[model samples]
Target: MRNRLKSNEGQNRRKKRTSDVEPVFGHIKSNRNFKRFTHKGIKKAELEFGLHALAHNLRKKVS
Candidate 1:
């Protein structure tokens, strides 16, 4: 894994992956203080996360 990331192609891929995905998680965890799921079951957990993602998208769109 270290060697792969050391290559040029892997470097570009890692950069793209982090740029696209990491900020949203960082914002959700740090800014929103969302650390864990309050619900217990899988269905409820999915719904909760879906709602959070929806709200994030809506907020991003509005701003």
Candidate 2:
């Protein structure tokens, strides 16, 4: 048996990502560009979500 955060386990988890999200909410509120989705339907929303995630990743890579 093993404990959590032991032997660098927790450190590994901390090294992983998070936060392709926090700024989006702020952007939506502060910038009208992201506020309100004119797009409709679950399928369309899902596609947009995927695209946003992909774009976020690409941006992170470039930066």
Candidate 3:
């Protein structure tokens, strides 16, 4: 894993990955205050997260 991260391709991928994903999670956790799922079952949790993702995308689109 360390060796992979040290390579050029891996470094580019890591940069792309963080840019693509980290901010959405940071916004969701910090701004939205979504710490944990309120639903219990796996399916319900997935549904709840799906809603959150949808809301995030919609907000991004609006802005």
Candidate 4:
């Protein structure tokens, strides 16, 4: 892991990856109260998650 972090390509990838995802998760956990999914199966779960994300974005837009 240390060696991987040392390379230029790896460093850039790491920076890009870290910037990409953390905030959405933090908001979902803290603001949305999204702890677990209620639906079962792939389609239902995907729909539920999409709705949650849409709600989160709408809240962001409104506030």
Best by the TM-score measure: 3
- Evaluated at residue 48, the lDDT of candidate 4 is 93
Against the unseen true structure, what C-alpha lDDT does each candidate score?
A: 0.92, 0.62, 0.95, 0.87
lDDT of 4: 0.87
Measured on C-alpha atoms, candidate 1 has an lDDT of 0.92
Model 2 regions lying over 4 Å from their true place? 1-32
**CA lDDT, candidate 3, residue 38:** 100
Q: What does candidate 2's lDDT look like per residue over 1-63, in tens digits?
A: 256655586656645523545676565446535555557998887787667667666766999
Q: Tell me the lDDT of model 3 at 15.
A: 98
Predicted candidate 3 versus true structure: per-residue lDDT over 1-63, tens digit per residue = 999999999999999989999999899989999999998999999999999999999998999
Best by lDDT: 3
Model 2: clashing residue pairs? none
Over all chains combined, what TM-score does candidate 4 have?
0.69
Which ranges of candidate 3 are over 4 A from the true structure?
1-6
The residue pairs that clash in candidate 1, if any, are none
| Tens digit of per-residue lDDT, candidate 1, span 1-63 | 899989999999989989998999889878888999999999999999899889889999999
Worst 10 residues of 3 by lDDT: 21-30
